[model samples]
Target: MRTSRAGTSHTVLWAGWAALAAGAVLCVIGWYGVSGERFAERQLPYLASCTVPGAALIVAAAVLLAHGRDATAAARVEELYALLVAAEPPREEAEGERPVAGELVAVPGGTLFHRADCPLVAGKAEAGPVDEHGRAGLDPCPVCAPDV
Candidate 1:
């Protein structure tokens, strides 16, 4: 589903690029026509038929390309945010077993243990109370070393 959305964005970007290229070609043709003409009356048909439409296409292509890029960036941000939320442990578990003051804490996969009040673990979503078994392989945090 996400890939499909990304594909649509890519399609829009490609369409915009194609439009830009076509516009440039049309403008070039108009310029060529005007350059070969001797009188202003002879050049008027080329200006009316090609130059004005070409400029409009270029402007529309720019807007389309910008919108496509913005959509792609927004999708990427949402996907990353979802992954971050999923990686976090459930709040209910942390709520049921809150760590007391001076207790050792560490994130699920972290190698270091820290004091409950340590700045490193303060706002971490995955940080939880580390029991004796949990503390076995973990090293004390240098930033806020917990007394064993």
Candidate 2:
């Protein structure tokens, strides 16, 4: 058997993590430089030969640049998903409420309901809604769409 791992957000997350790692390394180098003289005697031969603050600043800049890009990517993804769902038009449920357009399943007493539209089948799921009293209630699965 073979396996392939990919998802809509995987690329974005990879890019983010890669950038984060690079930035972290840069920050470490930069901080080392800014604190050079304080630990000159403990410095590595090659490291002692370089400008600490300069190295540190470069690292810090790399980190910041990567961090900025990562955040931008994440925000863009959210915007896209929002736009997709928004553009699809609203659905009306029999309850006179907007139908939960996500995935649904069976509850135990009736059916476990969840709010996702994934194609893969799933097991009983907890209700994603919260009541005013701060308690969660299991509602009808949208596909099976049982009454509460």
Candidate 3:
């Protein structure tokens, strides 16, 4: 079976919960055993046999539970990523239909103008020369900062 980054087994996770429940029961049993006893020496046996072991089981359960949760989250993220990767590819323009070199660019409704090669305008479909929209008086892009 495909495991997550943490590689924690599902069996371990189930065991953790089982251990936690059993530990709780053991602790309760120990408490009851000690509470009914009249002497301190009588309670010591319950502490040694039940309470101490119960507390140890709880600590082990905590580690197992945390590991299991991390693995579960990692697996979920992997599933989401697989789904994203399987989605349809975006449409592309023919080579002839693409914009030519030296196409001045700016984002629509944006304040700055940039050269076609500007990193800010790169890969943006909406970016085009201001004159195409009859827009004017825009400031130069601070990054590219084209003189034009």
Best by lDDT: 1
Find the number of clashing residue pairs for candidate 2: 12
Measured on C-alpha atoms, candidate 1 has an lDDT of 0.86
Quote the lDDT for 93 in model 3: 52
Specify the poorest-scoring 10-residue window by lDDT in model 2.
1-10
Q: What ranges in model 2 sit over 4 Å off?
A: 1-50, 90-148
* TM-score of every model versus the real structure: 0.65, 0.28, 0.73
- Candidate 3: clashing pairs of residues: none
Per-residue CA lDDT of model 3 for 30-117, tens digit only, reads: 9999999999999999999999999988998999888888777878788788779998876655665444556667787888878777
Best by TM-score: 3
Candidate 1 lDDT tens digits, 31-85? 9999999999999999999998888889989998998998799778878887888
- Overall local distance difference test of candidate 3: 0.78
Q: Report model 3's TM-score to 2 decimal places.
A: 0.73
Which of the two candidates, 1 or 3, achieves a greater TM-score against the reference?
A: 3
Cα error, candidate 1, residue 141 (Å): 11
Residue 106 in candidate 1, Cα distance off native in Å: 12
Per-residue CA lDDT of candidate 2, range 1-148, in tens? Answer: 1112223345445655665565566556655665664565565543644444345545655665566566667667766776787795444334433224442432334424444342222321332333233223554344644343
Clashes of 1: 0
Global lDDT scores for all candidate models: 0.86, 0.47, 0.78
